[model samples]
Structure formats: C-alpha cells, structure tokens
Target: MFWFLLIGLVSGWLAGMISRGGGFGLWGDLATGVVGSFIGAYVFNLIGLSAYGTIGSIISSTVGALILLWVIRMFNVAPAAAKKK
Candidate 1:
C-alpha cells in the first residue's frame, strides 16, 4: 500500500513534467497516478508486453498518466469546440 502510493506520486510528478502542463497538484496527481497505474498495466497487458521492476512500473504508469491527462484535455476542448460552432 505504501509503496503503491509512493510509486504513484513519483509517476504522477514525472508524467506532469513530461507532459508539459501545470499539473493537477498533489492529491489530484496521486489519484491520477493510482488510476493510471491500472491503466498502464491493462494497456501493457493488452499489447502482450510487461514491464519488470520498479523503474519499469514507473515508466508504465507515466505513460498511462499522460494518456489520462490527454483524454481529460480532449474532453475539456470538445465542449469549447462545440461552443465555437
């Protein structure tokens, strides 16, 4: 449990840095990372790939977090696009 949270925090912060945005702050990022870890695991499994060890886990979660953030941004943009039309 503790390791999961720590990994999530690290992955979230790393993803935020890589994605180039203000980020969701601490708690938000933690939530994002926790969810993203699941997402990453699922996606990797779907692709018939697996990551080994802690660093691998972080990379996987970071990718998932970026995807999660992108989806969120896309939804936010969709409404504004509708409004513009």
Candidate 2:
C-alpha cells in the first residue's frame, strides 16, 4: 500500500515531466498516478505483457500516465472552428 503510493508519485512526476514540462502539482499528480496505475495494468493485460517488481511498475505507470495525458489533451482541445473564433 505504502510502496504503491511512493511509486505512483515518482511515476506521476516523471510522466508529467515527459508529457508536459512540469508536474500537475502534488495532488493532481497523485490522482494521475493512481488512475494511471489502473490504466497501465489494463493495457499490459490486453497486450499480454506483465510488469514485475517496483521498477517495472513505475515504467508501466509512467507510460499509462503519458497516455492519459494525451487522451485528456485530445478531448479537451478546442475544435479548429472554435479556436478560430
């Protein structure tokens, strides 16, 4: 439980740095990390891949967070028509 939280924080920070330029603050990053953990596990299962140990978990979570950020950006982005207005 405790380890998961720590790993989530690290992975979230890393993902935020990679996807954007900085983190989304502590609580935001924590939320992203926790949600991304579930996403990562789901994705890995679908691909028949498994993450092992702490390092793998971090990597997986980071990847998931990146994906999550991308997805959020996609939907939240204004349409070209709206942008021009």
For this target, which candidate reaches the highest TM-score against the unseen true structure? Answer: 2
Clashing pairs in model 2? none
How would you encode candidate 1's per-residue C-alpha lDDT over 6-69 as one tens digit per residue? 8899889888887865666899779888888998999999998898999989988988888898
Clashing pairs in model 1, backbone N/Cα/C closer than 3 A: none
**Candidate 2, residue 67: CA error in Å?**
1.0
| The best candidate in terms of lDDT | 2
RMSD from true fold, candidate 2:
3.1
For residues 1-85, write the lDDT of model 2, one tens digit per residue: 9889888888889989998789989988887887888899899989999999999999889888888888998888687798667
How far out, in Å, is residue 63 in model 2?
0.9
TM-score of each: 0.83, 0.87
lDDT of 2: 0.88
Candidate 1's TM-score: 0.83
Error of 1 at 65 (Å): 0.5
